[model samples]
Target chain A: MTIITILDLLGTFVFAISGSLVARNREFDIFGALVVAFATALGGGTIRDLLIGVAPVGWMLDAKYLVAVIAGVGVAAFFSTILLKLRKTLFLFDTIGIGIFTLIGIQKALAQGLSPGVALMMGIVSAVFGGVVRDILCNEVPLIFRKEIYATACLAGGTIYLVGIHLGVNNTVAMVACMLLIIGIRLISVMKKIALPKI
Target chain B: MTIITILDLLGTFVFAISGSLVARNREFDIFGALVVAFATALGGGTIRDLLIGVAPVGWMLDAKYLVAVIAGVGVAAFFSTILLKLRKTLFLFDTIGIGIFTLIGIQKALAQGLSPGVALMMGIVSAVFGGVVRDILCNEVPLIFRKEIYATACLAGGTIYLVGIHLGVNNTVAMVACMLLIIGIRLISVMKKIALPKI
Candidate 1:
């Protein structure tokens, strides 16, 4: 598998785990937990594909992604204490996941002939929408909609990706650089307790 | 426009009004109100179309739906008291809206070669997903997942639609009957304060 694909699967797994954790916290049933996990892992890509007219969606075409998500649910269900104790590790994985998701979303949108501006928006949407959907399902205001710089990081990275490409950077280099940028912004913002001004 | 087209727009308007009312109750700003209104009105149809691989979405293809949603937002913003007093009227419109949404969703799914069972699911998703999304955005457990028999009504109506078609009923007759069945079920369930047992 390509490095990007591996990263995508890892990201999906982390997101799914996060979703299952939230569902368990809410005391949802096993079915609800699985639903939340699946939605968290696949919702953003599904939204992106649908918006761009891709049929059947990505996970629908590959069983590996489903396996990863199911594994995530299993981890959350059976290893709650261990998982919760690894807050720093989990946060690192989550940041990397969003970074990869944003880059892939931009690439897909651009491949579909969308303008750069629209592609950037799609990238941010792909990076953040799964968490948005998960929080909404768990009856909480979405973190991105609150005083978080979460989506802002994705937006900034997407812009940088476009700029790097325009500046004659290799596609692979631009993607990697953009991913690192997103990861850095997210990590720094969380560590520094930085947030957008509340409306 | 066809009768279905007109009903679809009406459904969008009523759903938008409901969303805007919820946003107003939450004291969201005007922009928030408008965003909520649009999501509520188009969310269900958008989900259905995306699942079926319809590109650009129905609203993106037609301006009338957007106009209807905007009108609904206007009513919510400028006539809150008047609208609140018309609870019965609003309920009636909402019931009809779901009815039409269900039938149209079933038709679309069937046209795309989905099985009867999947088509039924699509129908219910189309009927209720807008409210699901609206409630989620407003940070509430969705009514359908709570005690309401809302989705049950849609499922029942969709089954009837498929059965009627199998029994050699006219297409239009089956559709109209399905719509009435949904409307009647929803209205009766509400009037009798009926609820599904809590999980």
Candidate 2:
């Protein structure tokens, strides 16, 4: 598989696990947990695809993503304590996942002939919408809608991608740089407890 | 506009009003109320169209829906007391809105060559998903996912549409029958306090 595809799958898996964790924490049933996992893994991309007019969505065309999400539910169900212990590690993975997904979203939107501005919005949407949906499902105001720097990090990464491309950077180099930028922004924000001003 | 188109717009308006009311109750700002209203007005059809591969979505193609949603937000913002007094009237409008939107969803799915079962699912999704998204955004478990008979009513209406078609019923007649079925089911369920058995 291409590096992008691998990253995409990994991102989906981690997001699904995060979703299932929230669901389990809320005392949702197994079915509810699975539904949450699926939504978290695929909801952002599904929304993106629908906005860009791509039909059947990405997961519907590829069974591997489904497998990854189901595996996430299984892991969350059977390894809750272990997963809890790995909170730091999981947070790292989640940061990288959002970074990669943001770049992928930008590329997909560009490939679909969207303007740069729209592509940037799509990238941000792809990175944060899953978590938003997950929080909403768990009956919490979405963190992104609060003071979190999450969506802003994605926005920063997408802007970097656009600028890099505009400066004639190679596509692969631009993508990697954008991902790193996103990961760095997210990590720094969390470490410093920085947040956007509340509305 | 055709009767279906008019009904679709009316559905959008009522759904928007419902969404805005929820946001107003939650004490969201006017912008937040408008966002919620738009989501409740167009979210369901947007999902259906995206799943069925129709690009640009219905609201994007018609400005009337946007206007209706804006009007809904205005009504909620400027007349909170009056809106509270009209709760029963609003409920009736919401029921009829779901009924019309359900048939519209089914028709759109069938036009796109989806199977009857899928069409039925699309119908239900169209009727209820906006409210689902609205409730989720407001940090509540979607009523349809709770004990409410909302989605089941849509399913029943869709089934009636399918059976009517199979039995060689006229297209217009079948559409009207399905709409009434949905409205009746929803109204009766509310009046009788009927609910699906909770898991």
Candidate 3:
């Protein structure tokens, strides 16, 4: 019912769809696609929880996320062409999802008494590492490492959020600002094909 | 120094060495090699600990494992040809390492009061997932999933270990038996090119 919960489930669904689509593109079978979809949807949060000592993980406590992921996979499976046509819209939603995930990750890590630097790192990890993981399993260099401004966008947003909180900004206000910054960065950078300069 | 601790460190060393060597073979730069080596040495245990809710993970609390991994990378860098000549010896030690890792993973999960089935999976994850992660990061299908009976060996050993406990077998005896069986299975399977059948 809460907006955060809604965004979290929506993110899970969008992530799973992207994962399933990638698996299909690689000529994977249904089972492999499911595995990839699940990993992409939940792997980041699982890593964050493990690092912060959260037992059972977030998804384990909520069946909604699981249901959303499965639904995403099902939609990807049954509506590949239709989904492909909606790529731009899905990607916008995906960007929003990552922003929310970053916020959630930072909040959870901070709640666990982790230092701000680590909380920021976990935010980026939760935002992008699922796709990082998905790429790895599919036998490619992780996109975040080799290309794109993906994780950096998370870092920037997280930094703003942390700094705002440090400056006594309202929690809800800081969160909204963080999400907006990440979305703007993701969209603008992708449209411009901006990437970190290669070493 | 208990034998278990010693074996654990040695396993970490060997895994790191293998990881470093693989990185070098791929023409990766030193930074990439180091990343691969560290992941190979500790990634499995990290995954296991996270799943079982061990906060901060195993290597975070100890410096020795990091030292071992660094040493392995250094050795691999300077003695690539020499290490290649010792491949058979390294393989033998690696087999032993995997066996010990399996035991440790199972014990840790069981200590956390997880079900035996989950514990068995954790054992395999601990024994081989470091390599799984290494391979994935390096843009290869995880070797265990594709080309070997490696994880099956862990499952076999872990199953025996669990059943032995169920049958009221002595703890130390079961541990040793599990290690020996894993080693035996690994060595024999590799020598005979045994693998699980493709689906």
Candidate 4:
């Protein structure tokens, strides 16, 4: 597999794991956890595809991705009990997943020739929409609104990526820079307990 | 308002009311109910707009629609006790709202130059996605999946709309025909306790 494809797959797996972990934390059953995991892993891309008038969403088109998510769900189900013992590690993985997804989303939208604003929005959607949906399905307020920093980090990553592209940076380097930017911002945001103004 | 605008407003109002009533049924607090009501009222159109790549979303572009939904939520909040007593009438109103939304979705998709298959999917989404979302937020399996022939009836209406459009029927006549088709099919489906096969 190409480097980009491998990275994409890695991102998907991490995202799926994050989703499954969240469901597990919520005490959902095995099937329910898998459903939430799959949705959280794929919901953003599905929405993006639908919005862009694309058919046969990415996961639908690529069976391997679907398999990866299913496998992720299975692994999570098996390890859920042990994994619950490592909350900090799971939080790290979830943040890393967000970082990876933001970059991938921006790249995909740019590949489609969308404007930077739209691409940024797509990135935020890709990184956070699934979580919002997962929360909604779990009958809770979305973390993006309540948690604050999650989507803001995506916006920051997308902005950095856009700037890197404008400066003619190499694709791989640009992606790395933006991913780190998201990770750093999210880490800092959480550590400092930063929050947006409540209306 | 223009004829088209008035029709759209009526559809939005009824849709919002259906959403509010469902929120009430779920015993959501006022804030939660408003969120549910707003989502139920406009979720379908927002999704339709996003899928068809319509900019800004229709409700976002027109503040009146937002105001109407807020008004509907207010009405529901103020008369929660009285409105809760009229459960059967609320069901009928919900059915009517679904019919109106199905027509609007199909028409808008056709206007956007989509094919019949896509338009039909859009119509089903418009008619049923909101309720799916509501159920998810309320922590229940969607009615379309379990309880009745909700989406199937919308599909039938979409088919009628497609046939009428292909046959060069007048717009109003075709609309009335499709609307009646949806309402009749839904009522019958509910009476007969029909449902789609679960996968």
> Which sections of candidate 3 miss by over 4 Å?
A1-41, A44-53, A56-132, A140-199
DockQ of each: 0.18, 0.19, 0.17, 0.09
lDDT of 3 by residue, B138-196 (tens): 87876664566788788889999999999999999999989999989888888999876
The interface RMSD value for candidate 2 stands at: 4.2
List model 1 lDDT by residue over B61-180, tens digit each.
889989999999999888888987998898888888898999998988788776676677678778888877887778787656555678878888899999999999998999898988
Estimate TM-scores for all models. 0.61, 0.61, 0.62, 0.58
Per-prediction interface RMSD in Å: 4.2, 4.2, 4.7, 7.3
What are the clashing pairs of model 1? none
Candidate ranking (DockQ, best to worst): 2, 1, 3, 4
What is candidate 1's lDDT per residue for A3-59, written digit by digit as tens?
989989999999999988887777665545665787788888888887876765666
Which number leads on lDDT?
3
For model 2, which pairs clash?
none
Candidate with maximal DockQ: 2
lDDT of 3 at A29: 51
The chain A TM-scores for the candidates, taken one by one, are 0.96, 0.96, 0.97, 0.88
Best by TM-score: 3
lDDT of 2 at B134: 85
- Model 4, span B62-162: residue lDDT tens: 56887778888777767767766876776676677777788888888988999989988998888788777777666677766777788888888878878
Least well predicted 10-residue stretch by lDDT in candidate 4 chain B: B26-35
* Two-chain complex of model 1, DockQ on C-alpha atoms against the true structure: 0.18
How does candidate 2 fare on TM-score? 0.61
Encode model 2's per-residue lDDT on A1-199: one tens digit a residue.
Answer: 9988888888888898998887766666554566578778888887888788678666655668877898888888888889889999888888888988888788889999999999999998888888777777777778778766898898988898899999999988888888888888888998899999876
Q: What C-alpha lDDT do the candidate models reach, one value each? A: 0.84, 0.82, 0.87, 0.75
